[model samples]
Target: MSPTLVFGVIAAYFILLLVISYFTSRKADNNTFFTADKQSPWFLVAFGMVGATLSGVTFISVPGEVGNTNWTYLQFVMGNMVGYAVIALVLIPLFYRLKLVSIYEYLRDRFGQNSYLSGASFFLISQTIGASFRLFLAALVLQLAFFDAFGIPFYVTVLTNIALIWLYTFRGGIKTIVWTDTLQTTFLLLAVVVSIIMIINHLDLSVPQVFTVVTESDLSTIFEWDWRSGQNFFKTFLAGIFITIAMNGLDQNIMQKNLTISNTGDAQKNILWFSITFFIATVLFLSLGVLLYEYATTQGIALPGRSDELYPMLALNHFGAVAGIVFLLGIIAAAFSSADSALTALTTSFCVDILGLKRKEHKNQNRTRMLVHIGFTILMFFVIIIFSSLNDSSVVSAVFKVAGFTYGPLLGLFAFGLLSKRTVNDKFVPFVVILSPVISIILDYNSEAWLNGYKFGFEILIVNAAITCLGLFLLKGNGKNERLNEAENL
Candidate 1:
């Protein structure tokens, strides 16, 4: 496909998003931007979240992962089902009951000011890095597909990508995202389905024959019974459960949309339906992976050195121009759907959590919100640039690894607040939170050497949270009214 054609497709897509933003942001205020005035349709939020959850990383990397790890990633997908149930049953009810604009506000009501800041701070760091990493992958693809052909520098591509997201998202925020993401999700799923059909037609195989070929391939193996392997079924499954709890249930980017729903029942329905759709969507991506590998081997095509490049390389170079066009639109849809929401959630978190915008009655509140939104846009631009320079592993693995360290403190803080009754010394909460991830990093670095070559996978998040919980227990206050006194001190 020509660079000009690909650029035209992306430009058209953004114009559509801007059109949606213009309508959604009309008569909007702080409440509308931050929480969509709690009027979002449950069905829209559920459908839109499919694109948000998959993001650009999954769009590109999951299919590529098949060549190396087979279908073992499905273990984590199964675990996600359990995790979504927890979110629907446990977390959604708590947020609705508390009437929270920011989910971390629950930390404030349960713990003191210091603990509240700690939880919010961890989310800020986690989402900033997480969102940046995802955009970085998307920017790299854009660069490869369009910019490099025009002799454009990589940094220019990064800035342009962030700028487009800011343009659509700055006014309507989550309100715009709810509608825009639904549209993007449609294109994303269409791209996948179209690519699958094209591959099947190219191979001249029927639907049953495709499944039969996939089942016969080694890449179709789903379970990992080897206890010592990092991809062991139990480890990945449990990791998926905790990861969904920490990253989605506890995450501001995701729960921000859930909080936009007016009531607990609707929010729960959104989560349940999102989980079912997510499972089916993931199976489709994995099946595409199987087909890609089968096509490559049958056609005697040489695969790329990085497993991450497999899908893009084949789609652009081998599958002809129509497939190339679909791939371009699909990735742009996936990237923007995720990035726009992260930008809104980050702005929402900083304005409400750090600046106390909800408490203040300033005339310039809208101005301040826009400024904070721009600040995060710049912050993510730099973070993406840094990751582009430094990232060497699978983009998916890098994302989850960072989640294990950064989100661990959040998991522990929330667990301590909800599961236990005791309040920790407020001043010491920061120290414990900081120490948990540091210890997790050390253990992760030396797990093989120090524990007789026992490899730790995504389940390391569970270990990281446990350490933080233990630290909080040791710092617990003695008196029954310790939490009361701590609140009064603030």
Candidate 2:
């Protein structure tokens, strides 16, 4: 737990990433950056996505929540499996058939320019907030556990964090991230497995004994049938389905990697495989949570005021140097795995969705992408600072809540486009997308009083999409779409 030792671990890790970037990005161009030249292997994408999908939020936040919510988050993961299946069967083929780089371009082709920008705008905003939140947790940890010991301010820690991500990602973009993510996922999974082993050894329990201790405890509660509660099984399951559809299916950040596969079949395989591995990873984290609490109670450790701080507090201070190393490795790997690709995807989204970089001369595209990449890095630094001041709840909750509002319009826009034959009035498309989430906020705030003590949970995403769908339906037009089902001839 020495500050000097923590700095050495981080420096060594960043150097490894830079070395990987050097090899992967040697001849990378805009195609390489945006689409990885459509040559990524399906299995690598599948394994790597486990890290990106869970990210720092699950790495630190999910395990800490066992004391508060138990294993009910598993219900959400179950819903994710169903959601990923839908994406593989339906959304993947459609995206591949269309040959998309930025997924929001589908909006422009289907509903006209107005809808396209609106969809892309939502992605930019949501991803900025989400990535900032993830990176903020990692920075805050480094600041408290290491940097503060050296008299470094919080802002310097954040700047260094963003700078490292930008260093490795500015050139190869998604191509670099795909390879780096695979490596990071390996380290992340290893960290958790080793940490569990360390805990059980300290407690003098065998694998079977530990498993029984975790599963038989109250912390293992995974289902809630009370319909009024936010953690109700049905609500969590449904929310999982919709959130995956929005965050994974429609998201440029997640889909950007899938699009790197050369064919529809391979991309679909990547997604289906990712779903299975993601489920296993979540269960491991939850079990780690159960053990963490057990260890704390048995050792007479005082719990941190915030659930999110419990794991770090124990790992760094009480669990020995090896445990501290494992926790730091798990979190930084988790943070960079998601945040790096997010930078590339945000750059891709802005360049293609709003700036029309694709339509410009090929010579200039890479320059614009590089600039936009830098712009987003700076934006994340400021946003992370802002979030540091205001974040009061567990980060996992904050991220999903933000997604419920921002990603909802994307779900509504895509659903209406594919399900209906009639076109939308393009000029009014933006308004409908904007208004839907506002209505959702009003309803969610009043749901308890209006519905006899019922509270809204992740299902707010479903309601937000439904409201947008109704508004879009009211503005339906006479034109029919022809471009969607047919693959464009390159």
Candidate 3:
């Protein structure tokens, strides 16, 4: 594809997002900034979340994974369904009953002020690093595809791209994000669908032939029953539930949008729709990978070392100008949809939870809040550049390793709140939560060294969760009535 056409399509796509932002941000205020006045349609949120859920990581990563990982990632995606169902039935009702602007506020009510901060702080660290790294990855790929020709420095490219996101999101917060995410997701889904059809025709394979090749090619098998392995069936399903509960049900970034819908019932319905749509959409992308691989095998193209680049590289080289353009659009749609929302959620959580901006009723709250929003956006700009420059695959994996620690404490905090009644020693709560992960990290690192051949994967989440639950037990005061201790008699 010509650089002119690729750049033109991408520019037009950004303009479309800006238009959505403009309409949504008009007359935006504290209520709109925080929760969209609890008036956003649940169906819109359900559809919008599809984009946020996939993000740039899944957009490029999952399809590529099909080629390299033999399509076992679908097991995790299927596990996500069970996770979402649990979120709808249990977490949504609790958040609704509390009338929470920041979901972490429940931590204070259930445990103490320190617990609240502990939860939010973990979220800020994890989301900031995770979002910035995701943006950096997408920016690097975009730079390779488009800006390398013009000799544009990667940092300049990163700044310009993130600046565009901040431009639209600085006003409306979650209100604007809900609508923009939906629009971006629509474009993203359309791009994927179009690419699939084009690739199928290009390969001259009928639908049955495509499925036959994929099923026969050793990439479509789903079950791995080995408990010790990374992609094991039970581990994937259980990890799916835990990850969904911790990441989606507990984290402010995702749940904030879930809270924006009108009521508990609406939010619950939206969760259901979001799960079903997300699963189907993921399957579509994975199938696209199957087709792409089949086409590459027929054509004999060289694959990149990192599986993540397979989709873009193939589209640029083999699928010609039209598919190349579609590929770029899909990447932009996927990257911005999640990146923009992450920025908004970061702003929302900071302004509301950590900063206590949401509790204020001052007329100046809007002005002050805008400053906070812009400040974080700028912070993210530099953070993304630093992470992009490091570019070490294991270094990125380490960030995820540290970030994984946050989820266990989160899961323990919520589970203790809902499932137990003991009054926790507020002073020791932070120590317990913080120490659990640090201890787990030490143990996890030494396990392989001491045991000689022990390995870990997503199971780290399970171990972290267990340590958190243990910490909670240690913090409970003796002779205190369990929070649920009295309820069982009812």
Candidate 4:
């Protein structure tokens, strides 16, 4: 592939996103920005969610992961299904009853102001770092692919990419995110399909043969059966269920989309369908990883040093120019789908939850909202730059680790309110909330050193949840107000 051609295709793709941004942002006010006036189609939200669920990390990491753990990550997919089911059945009802602009508001209503702020604060921390890391991964590729001229630093690349995401997402918020995510998901899946076909042709493998090769090969195993092993089937399955419930079902970014539905029933349906489709999509990506490994082995080509680059480099090397262009577009789609949504959700949550900016405020309210958007954009810019500068090999691991602690507190706060009849002492709640993650992090760090390789993985969320429950138990608000508080809880 000529550099000029690759450059042109990538440039043209981003230009299209900018054009979509312009159209989506034009008529967007706070209502349109945050919830799309509650007019967004549930089906579109589900469709677009496919892309958002699988970011650049999945795009690159899944195929690479095939080589490492015998494709055991599929166990986590089962866990995801369980998670989504809990979200649809349990969490959605609570969220709908609250009629919330920010899901965290339910915490305050049920528990107290401290619990509310605690949940929102944790979201701000988790999404900021998680989103930044996603952009950081994409920026590294873009820098290596296009901006390696004159020795431009990776930090500059990270900042530049985040700025672009902010520019488009700032105006329309969730309104633009819904439509843009749908388009991005389309591109991402198309890229995957095209790449799979190209790889199959290159391998001279029929569809059955492709499956045959994958199944007969070492990469198709689903269960480790070893209790202590990473990616053990049962553990991954249970973890997936909890993760979806805790992370997506309860978290603001994903539930924000669900809440955009006109009614609870429709939102529930959307989540059900999204979970089913999400599981199918995970299988497809894993299959692609298996095929890529087969293709590389047949051609006697050494895989890239970093497993993360397996699919990208394979497309570039074997399928040549056309596939390379497709790969770049897919990467952009995969990266922006989540990045734009993350930025928008963060802005929406901050304005309404933290700053008390009402979605139904006066016309001049746009100024405050826009400032909030810009503030988050700037924050994303700096965070990505710092992440890229550090160039941590375990960036994704770190991102999920943060989620385990931060989102567990979110889950705990929500559960404490939903399942219990007690009102948390508002003043002490914040300290408990703050201490949960700090304690989880400390435990996570020391646990591995003291207990050997028995470090926390996804199950650390369980620990965080337990600590939060313990904190809630310590609070003994008067029973006289319990019924009233529980009634108002989200």
Candidate achieving the largest lDDT = 2
lDDT of 2 by residue, 418-468 (tens): 777667788998899899999999999999999999999999999999999
Q: What is the C-alpha lDDT of each candidate?
A: 0.89, 0.91, 0.78, 0.79
Better of 1 and 4 by lDDT: 1
Which candidate, 3 or 4, has the higher TM-score? 4
Model 4: residues with Cα > 4 Å off, grouped in runs:
391-396, 448-455, 482-490
Worst 10 residues of 4 by lDDT: 481-490
lDDT of 3 by residue, 308-419 (tens): 7778787776777777777777778788877887887788788877878864446788777888788878888888877766665433244446556767788887787777
RMSD (Cα, Å) of model 2: 1.8
Candidate 1 wrong stretches, greater than 4 Å: 359-362, 481-490
Predicted candidate 1 versus true structure: per-residue lDDT over 361-422, tens digit per residue: 35599899999999999999999988888987888888998999999999988877778777
Stretches of candidate 3 above 4 Å error? 359-363, 394-402, 449-452, 478-490
- lDDT-wise, the better of 2 and 4 is 2
lDDT of 1: 0.89
Q: For residue 391, what is the lDDT in candidate 4? A: 57
Model 2 lDDT on a 0 to 1 scale: 0.91
Clashing pairs in 3: 421-482, 421-483, 421-484, 422-483
Q: If candidate 4 were superposed on the true structure by all CA atoms, what would the RMSD be?
A: 2.1
